[model samples]
Target: MLEIRQIPVLEDNYVYLVHEPVEKLTAVVDPAVTDEVMSAAASAGWTITHILNTHHHFDHVGGNEEIRDKTGCTIVGPRADRDRIPGIEIELGDGDLFQFGAATARVFDVPGHTKGHIAYWFEADKALFCGDTLFALGCGRMFEGTPGQFWPSLKKLRDLPDETRVFCAHEYTQANARFALSIDPDNVELTMRSKEIDALRAHGIPTVPSVLAAEKATNPFLRADQPEIAAQLGMEGRDPIDIFAEIRHRKDNF
Candidate 1:
């Protein structure tokens, strides 16, 4: 079985540890801070064996080199972005399968936030480690790719099973929820979730690993194809990509 845990780090960033009990192997995903990841591993009683980076953003891979030096973990990431990732030994692209002990992760090229960004999907475990590409109730900003390119990238993720657990890189859900409500006011799921988020935050609980089904229901970015959202944005009958672009544009200002 696979075990996952969240490690809170710098500001609102989140790092995750994926563990395989059979082989006692542990992989750190997007370590924004080295100390936080090391402490998390120490607390979990698991020795780090791998560093899986989803993108080259500094906040995501800032601890790559230090973590590799401290634990000698094998670093893995997008083969196309070898130049950007630090200490990357296993450069992989979309469709490439990787193993950490008995667990396997399938890579998907999900560019938009960054041109070479990728996500790791552990199909059997129904978990997705999508760094900055997909968030709890929002998507990443288009830094290197166009909205057209981003829409297709999000489609690849939306096609995954709704039950898949989404592990994002940040605690942007509350803010994203507020922004989503502006355009998706009629969405009951979003409304209820916003309240839940408020409760979770008030109690200092982490809301990083949200279920994909919930995101599908509440995330405005994913609901671009919905006519209700289109009509709300004055985009009725427009192409889904155009609607999605407008949503993203609004988010940029939100």
Candidate 2:
């Protein structure tokens, strides 16, 4: 079994440490800072052996060099953004299989927040380490990719098993639930989820690693193709991508 630990850092970002206990091999996902990640690994008695980066964003790869230098870990990341990834030793693409001790992860090129962004899905573990691509109640903003490119990227993730646990890189669920309610006010699931999120946030609880089933049922971004959502946007019969773009536009300004 793979043991995963979440370490919150830099206001809202989350750094994950994935460990395979048999071999005691551990991989740190998107370490934004060095000290917290290093300390967490030390406290857990896990030695970091790999750095799995999802994109080239500074927040995601900021500690790559330091961590790798300290532990002599192999750095893996998207081949599309190789130039930007610090200490990238293994450049991976879509459909590529990456090995971490006894576990394996299927790499997905899910670009939207960034053109070279990727996600790691450990099928057996039912875990998806998606950095800034798919969030709990929303998707990442289209920073470098267009709606055309972004929608397909989301579709790939949307097709995953319902039981998959989404380990997104930020604590944005509370704010995302608010935006979801505005667009999908009538959805019973969304309403319930929004209230749940509010309660969780009120108590200072972390609301990440949401189930894929809940996200598909309640996230407005994932429901753009639903007729009800299109009707709510006053864009009945429009292309899903167009509806998605509109929702993203509204959220951008919200």
Candidate 3:
């Protein structure tokens, strides 16, 4: 079985430590801080064998070399981002398969937040390390890619089983939920979820790895096609993609 833990770093970044005790192996995703990664590995009593970078963003790969220099772990990153990523010994691409323990991860090319951004899908375990592509109640801002690229990229994850556990890199659930509610205040799922997320934030708890089912039901970006969202946003009968773009634009200012 896979043991997963979230190591909070910086203000809102979440570095994931995934381990399989039976194999005594560990892998970390998006290490923003070396000390946090080291502490998590020590807590789990597993030697980290690999550091996975979803993109070349500094907040995601800032500690790559430091961690690798300290632990001698292999750095794996998107093959397309060789110039930007640090210490990448293994260059990965879409369709790449990597072993975590007894389980496997399939690489997904999810560009939008970054041109070379990728997500790791552990199908058997139903876990995803999606960087900034998909969030709990929102999607990442388009930084280096087009919305055309982003919508399809998100659709790829949306196509996954509803039970898949989505591990994103930030703690923006409460704000995202509020933005979602603006698009559909009558959505009971979003209404209830917003309160739950507020409580989680107040208690200093993590609001990540939300179930795909919950996101599908309440996330406005994922529900752009729903009549409730379109009507509430004064965009009745609009194309879903346009509605999605408008919502993202509004959130950028919000």
Top candidate, metric TM-score: 2
Q: Please provide, for model 2 over 72-109, each residue's C-alpha lDDT reduced to its tens digit, 9 standing for 90 to 100.
A: 99999999999999999999999999988799999999
Q: Write the per-residue lDDT of candidate 3 for residues 1-254, one digit (tens) a residue.
A: 78899998898999999887777778889998898789889987888888999999899999999999888999998987877899998888888998766889999899888999999999988999999999999999989987777888888889889999999999999989888877778888789999999999999988898999999999888877789888888999988778878888999998
Number of the predicted model whose lDDT against the real structure is largest:
2
Instruction: Candidate 3: list runs displaced more than 4 Å.
Output: none
Candidate 2 error regions (>4 Å) = none
Model 1 segments more than 4 A misplaced: none
Model 2 TM-score?
0.99
User: What TM-score does model 3 achieve against the real structure?
Assistant: 0.96
Pairs in clash, predicted candidate 3:
none
What C-alpha lDDT, on a 0 to 100 scale, does residue 244 get in candidate 3? 79
Measured on C-alpha atoms, candidate 3 has an lDDT of 0.89
lDDT of each: 0.92, 0.94, 0.89
lDDT per residue (tens digit) for residues 167-206 in model 1 = 9999998999999999899889899999999999999998
**Better candidate number, 1 or 3, judged by lDDT:** 1
Q: Candidate 1: lDDT of 37?
A: 92
